[model samples]
Target: MDPPTRSWSIYNRTEITQRYEILERIGSGAYSDVYRARRLSDDLIIALKEIHDYQSAFREIEALEILQKSPNIIVLHEYFWREEEDAVLVLEFLKTDLASVIREAKRNWENGISVGEIKWWMIQILHGLDACHRNSIVHRDLKPANLLISSDVVLKLADFGQSRILLEPGFVTGDEHTHPHEQNTPSQTWMLQQPETIPESDNSNQEQITMSKEEYFKELDDLKAKDSVDETDKETNFNDGDTSCLATYTTSDMEDNPFKSSYSYEAESEGDRSGALTSCVGTRWFRAPELLYGSMDYGQDIDLWSLGCIFAELLSLKPLFPGTSDIDQISRIISTLGNLTEEAWPGCSKLPDYGKISFGKIENPLGLEAYLPNRSSDEIHLVRRLVCYDPASRATAMELLHDKYLNVNPLPVPVNELRVPSTNNGQDESSPGQWRDYKDMDSDSDFEEFGTVDASTTGTGFSIHL
Candidate 1:
């Protein structure tokens, strides 16, 4: 037999390029462990992710190619393979995740959900997802764990391992076709080879074949234009920090094709969509309905569903759907939203996994007011729309970002407030520029703190050793 796969522990120290120091292990995942590191060049904070598999390393690189440009997405500084160990990816470090926030919220209170906090968090995540979808990149896996918040309060969407570029039609999917590096050449064995079965017809919202490519492209273009308008403010970076210079970061440094090709997913069994690349989202708890049934071709809408679930979990401190199995997951959703009727089941028939399933007849309609108490009926109405079981009916990121509930009292955690400059040697490094400090601000504090800090101390902040 071949040698056993080598195991690397997160606690153990791992050397990097004989320069950067691995401060400590911050987090761990199935394929890699994330560590908080200090770059020796400037002693700045950074994250080092070590991936054991060579193939996974390439896939991460491919995903980053399209996703790295957006400010909402986490920044990837560098990536390299070590001759002695495995592949290493350098990233901007983050302190807390949305999952942590949800847990914290649960421990602090013994009552109903915090409507204000929930609304703000939901809007922030939607903004990020909106940016991702606008760029033709889909963060197929968007759960609380993947949303990172730095100590400075910068919210970034992390873990693009399952992300992919939604390809233009008539284009075949492959490793080389998708990745800009051209590391892997085209091979028939690698082509996306889904079964040639006709999709079941849905009388309702089945694939509207008449929707032309031009129309789709136009919609995508409009979305991008809207994001450009949003970014013109030059202040919001989804982080809770304030800085003189904008927090400039990139998700990938793909010098080649930005919008490369489509991803190639291998199949799990026969007759199923083989080679239909899946960004197989986590478990039923975090999965969108479309993902639970197994869709070969899906988009960023899956991320939106996860965002809604995470928002609910933050308020409830429990997963919105804690189903033991896929069927159970569907049951919980149908129970909450009521069984899919012909009105909302337009494209359901076309879905490969939409076979006969047992769902109890609807009795009581799920009232958002009961689930998410104290919120206005209007806001609750919006939340219901967001968490709908039907993917088509679910709120798009753009729509949610501009929702009325977000516009009302307790505005989003201002990006400027999130950036707290580090106090090195008892002096602020980012001072001398009239920057606002967020030292004593509470979780419920709003934009009123933007100009509250003493100007002299923080405005003078700027001490980069580099």
Candidate 2:
């Protein structure tokens, strides 16, 4: 098959070509394509992410810059952007991600991942997420695919395209307990707007304006507050409580019901602050229940729900809730954890599409124990903390780090002691050409082979299987 089309003219640019040897394309998505390249300056292997969407690029850049100091977060060396061109981000490259590790274990290990190794992975994930949460950033998309592992067996969080920095009321630094979405208005705008145009200049000499943490948060607060007021006014006449005026459903409504009401999940366009934050941001299998109900108003607790799903997958070497569509996703969730109700999660009825969608009540829900029969009680408790119906009751990353499960005698293994597969997709990485050939193959094919869906490719949601 012919190689996928390159939307960005990154290969032809003199500045990019001179600085990094574009080795091969490793991953692709609707708005971005990632390449495994060698830095010309230091011969260091790196990933060059060419993002076609200005909003996504800006968000990733801003989030990574704030998280550069954290060891568990991916390092953004630098980025290159110019007028009317795609942004190219220079990022650290890792041989494999947690998905690959899980796949390898399922194939090779007789008993699946060891308890100690699982603890190590969980510890790393918690640390990375703790760093993000501490900075008031929500990694809307968190799955095994996004949790990349380094050569030293260290896991770091990657792919911040869907991540949002909480600059609104409860999300400011030092206010950890307050839920971010409690007081959030429907008019709150995204902080990373299209940047002002810079004068035409050579890429090598382009200078970046770094904003201090204090100044950055201050500016974000001012922007969000201003946008909220302006949008509230524009929407005053149209903000009636009736939901009939919203975008109507289509023929595919049963398959993937589009969220288009005042609580629509569509991200606002460049100059349009009328749309609500998308609830359809994450992959289907790991998505939180509130998100499935089209709740645009949510907080970092959503990540905790995803963490529970990921942990369950690691234990069984199979996805806990591998749904095919949005509706199917909720069915699978209900089948396992019982039907969602106001008693379980108070105010859940206030969710955008909560009334629009309905499900038969499950009389006897099979708990996590049904899926993880042989697992230890502590292990079950660990997943239980984050997989509950109430978002407020979900455990935080910091709190889980100190849990009894992680502090036991068979504690988490050292980073160096953790095992990682030597080869990715049967390609020996010791050979540069072989590694390049492996990376050149489309990532979707690999995902299909493993019965997993790459969330990056599907703009909607995704799933995973054994």
Candidate 3:
């Protein structure tokens, strides 16, 4: 038996000191230290990440290579295995992260981020996810901190250390994993560059303010139809892992209509993709139900789930599902999203951990309006679709941009108007913290370093390994 080979060549610490100068330490985690450094060759300011010698250190290199040309993803320049203790990755440096700007606004003397500004950030985040998924990559960890913002307020996807590139049989790491598509398409460019106009709401007061119960269900059915994965969308072949084999999800797998129960596949078809590279990878609060159910063969829908959770958090300044433990998390999700009945999740009983424990069948309202009282109809509708329980049905990033929720009255605030930490001179700081932010977020940070930890905690950590 042999140990898995890691990426990068050993860089002699003393000889290469002149090439890059470390300016200051920006952040330090249990596994690595992030530094702001200047590349002397051209005086390029790059973020140099030095991680302790471990298989996890090179995850970023693999992810970046696959996503190298994506405008929304952070660019990877140079990488080297430094000594035996670390591997260094040279990456594009951004001014700040969305988490910092969103969470620390009050400390910086700014009002809460306007819904419009949140909308803009949401668009960028989705674009980044689209880039990752287009190449069959899944960013298991998508918390606000991992979403970096440029000086001009452009959001760049960062920290691919926990990312997984979907494979043919199973997942492979390091150089063994060849990328599906390394190039971005002209269509993707056109989609990204499209003028982001916040359209006028087509729904009038009569339409927006009131809807017959029959009309409401009718609209939901219509929305579900719009979200369906049509024949045109399954063009990307997943064999080389370039989006072709989207058959990873069957016709039923992607049947995301809430009116219909969307589970119980008759065994995975040849097109079924089990993305079970690892469970328990995302920040707990934003984790999706499939991950909680221990779905090994999962897909890009998980990222969409987290994106929706982040969207809800931005609006309310509170986590939508702040579950402290796996059981508690499941409970919290059901309490709000309603019971995860076998009817809704067809294969709910088939999951590995499905019968391990039992959860009470507590029923609740399915109306997003009830949860997001002050939010617009479009926002609620979008959230409900994005956070849908059926992975087959979760809204893809591309579908989100055209969602009506974003085009409603009092549209998203523009990028220039976004408040910079040092520049929020006269604004009131109190409003930012007014949202139902958790008083105990410090406690949740305890799980930050447990990204790939073994699922030995039984229920403490929802990490499921087969």
Question: Which candidate achieves the best TM-score against the true structure?
Answer: 2
For every candidate, C-alpha RMSD to the true structure in Å: 20.1, 12.5, 17.8
Best by lDDT: 2
| Off by more than 4 A, model 1 | 1-15, 82-85, 109-116, 168-275, 367-369, 413-466
Worst 10 residues of 1 by lDDT: 237-246
> Which of 1 and 2 is the better model by lDDT?
2
User: What lDDT score goes with residue 281 in model 1?
Assistant: 43
Candidate models: Cα lDDT each: 0.50, 0.64, 0.55
Per-residue accuracy of model 1 over 102-156 as CA lDDT, tens digit each: 5444444565335565665676677677766665566665666567766656567
Q: Tell me the tens digit of each residue's lDDT in model 3 across 97-179.
A: 66556555535435466777778888888878888877678887676656776667777787665566675312233232333
Span of ten consecutive residues with least summed lDDT in model 3: 238-247
Ranking by lDDT: 2, 3, 1
> What's model 2's TM-score?
0.72
What's the TM-score of every candidate structure? 0.62, 0.72, 0.65
Off by over 4 Å in 3: 1-12, 82-85, 105-111, 168-276, 365-367, 408-412, 422-466
